[model samples]
Target chain A: MSGGKPLSRFHQPIEVPGRRLLHHIHLNFVKKKVVGGGGRSMNQEIPLIPFIDFLLCIVLFLLASFSASGELPIDKNVKLPNAMNAIEMMEAPIVAVTATQILVDGIPAGSTRAIIDSNTKQKIEELSEILKNKRELWKQLKPNEPFPGNVILQVDRKVPALVVKSVFQTAAFAGYPAVSFMVGRLAKE
Target chain B: MAGIDTGGGHGGKRSSNHEIPLIPFIDFLLCLVMFLLVTAVWSHMARIEADAKVPGPPREDEQDKIEPEKELHVHAKERKFQLVWKEGSTVVEESEVERVSVNVGDDVTFPELAKKIGKQWTDHGSHRAAADKKFDRAILHTDNNTEFGVVIAVLDAVYTPQREFLVGNKTEEVPAFHVTFAAK
Candidate 1:
């Protein structure tokens, strides 16, 4: 001990090879003892049980919400129409028609303004081409099952029906007969 | 008891007093939370499924020749919807359907239009309204300049009115009519 204070076991005094050394011992084996006002143990135990429980619950909920199809990519520009009687969303190649452009499978296919302005009863050339390619890819992936011809239309609520009609016709021309219009789900009364 | 030893008071300290490795557990949970938050789909997405008819050569056989079992055509315009019932090929003038057009004015929005359309279905369109109600299938033909919102609003209105029907063995509440979407 130095000046009535215990030294840590590691800081032992050195001695000659032939000489023996004597060290002071204290009842308190620890390096230091805190003289806290409260009669409490030296160790501070963090309240971790509640925190762990919360994290586990969060993990469980997120796992439950996770779906096999993964997350559906939503375009911020498209304000989807709300529907009360809509069914659960199906898996299909999404054809999103935004304010300015039309996208097939997240890739820009054509200009929305041009399609609306033309007002032609014909299928959209660009959209149809991309959809056809998607169809071919689908056919290759699932050779055994007949192609469902399912396609999802994610169109802005304000988009005129003319553009939607053109997209519909284009999807049909590209062998997509089953069209699913994606919409926000409204709570039932 | 089966956990990491914190090395507390090591003089004759027993391993049985070890505590759970909460720090490491917390780290693992944090990683999982981040992964799930990134991957989770928060919004509920719903689908309105319909068949898009492709223009093809007129059927040589009976599919086209035969009178459509139920011919209910809806002409969707910019501000009005003309709900028509057809017999054979002619658009019915007024034997069964009382009103054809439900117009949306400056004050009347699509929601109000939906309510009006739903009123029509619940009042006269469904077989529940009348035992001899004409159509069970309706065709929606949307025109240019009409907003897609209006089209979906009309669909929601049609789908709103439901009746419990015996299907196979179970009786379930289903939409009054099956709607097919078409563009003209």
Candidate 2:
């Protein structure tokens, strides 16, 4: 006991500022200290809360955006005709031709087939004139821009191909060049 | 010297480290959310809808009001082409013809049939004149089993440039020959 140094330095009690009181408690309770004579600090651990919050925000944003855009309702029973180059419908007029009816923007327009016989040539001419007038009116509505005007032809699988072609020709004659045939994507095999 | 030791000890013992500010990251994520929402809405706004139905002719009693020249019935059977004048219920003409080998069981080839009809129109103009002035329409009756492709082929043939005279003798060239699908 006589050879040992005085206990004053080893048992010294240090005073810290009041604002650092909680910090001191956390340091004592949470961090492990090395007890070797040579005392040095080690690198502290990084917090994970902010990183987690960031990822959550990203996920939530994606979910919110996807939910807002509604999917186009296509009839599963009808199989649409395929083409090598089919463009997506963007700002195009929708013309739905079901097995029993023809609808333009959900409104019933006319019968699927309109033919001109020698006797009804006058009627056919009248219809053609009306279509031409409508095309002119559309052009007037959106002047100075290349008519992004398109026709969406939704035909049933059972409808005759001739009927479909006739409709296509009629629309083409009416001055709409871009036509899109809508079809459902088949289930993966 | 005593104060210095105490200060060093406290500084070394501090557990909570300096952290990167998260406000910037939150702002970035919010911007991304807005961008995605705007894009989704734009796609929805760009969509369009259309319908595809073929029309058929009216019935006999219903046909009384319609002009006779407006209806022409074309009966396509195994190997015969029968042209019926609708208003008079009179068989204007019948022509026996060789059937195309193409899967045209009851479906007539429009091109071949149209050519034959064109020849008949020229040859029997007198008979057609005597039948009805409104004999402008041709009602095509096909078998249920006939392929739509064959019918289209027939229509293409009938409405071909060469067969345009079937519709009218007008100086202006008409691109389509008038014919309607007759209900069975």
Q: Candidate 2: DockQ?
A: 0.07
Give each prediction's DockQ, rounded to 2 decimals: 0.47, 0.07
> What does candidate 2's lDDT look like per residue over B1-184, in tens digits?
0012223335567644344556576576677766666655423122112222233245566544543442345666766656654445656656654555332343223445656766655554332332223324455666644444344444444433222223345433332235555532
What is the per-residue lDDT of model 1 for residues A1-189, given as tens digits with 9 covering 90 to 100?
Answer: 334333554655753344122223243333233433245558776777888889999999999998766668778889888877888887789999997999876799999988767767667788988999888988899999889889999999889878887788789878988888998876665
lDDT of 2 by residue, A123-145 (tens): 22332344466668788987877
Top lDDT hit: 1
Docking class of 2: incorrect
Looking at model 1, residue A174 earns an lDDT score of 89
lDDT of 1 by residue, B50-158 (tens): 6765555465673744554535676665545667666557765322222234333311124544555556565445365333333366788776777788777767766
Q: Model 1, A57: alpha-carbon shift in Å?
A: 3.8
| Superposition error at B94 for model 2 (Å) | 30
- The Cα RMSD in angstroms, rounded to one decimal, for candidate 1 relative to the true structure is 8.8
Q: Which ten residues in a row have the lowest lDDT in candidate 2 chain B?
A: B44-53
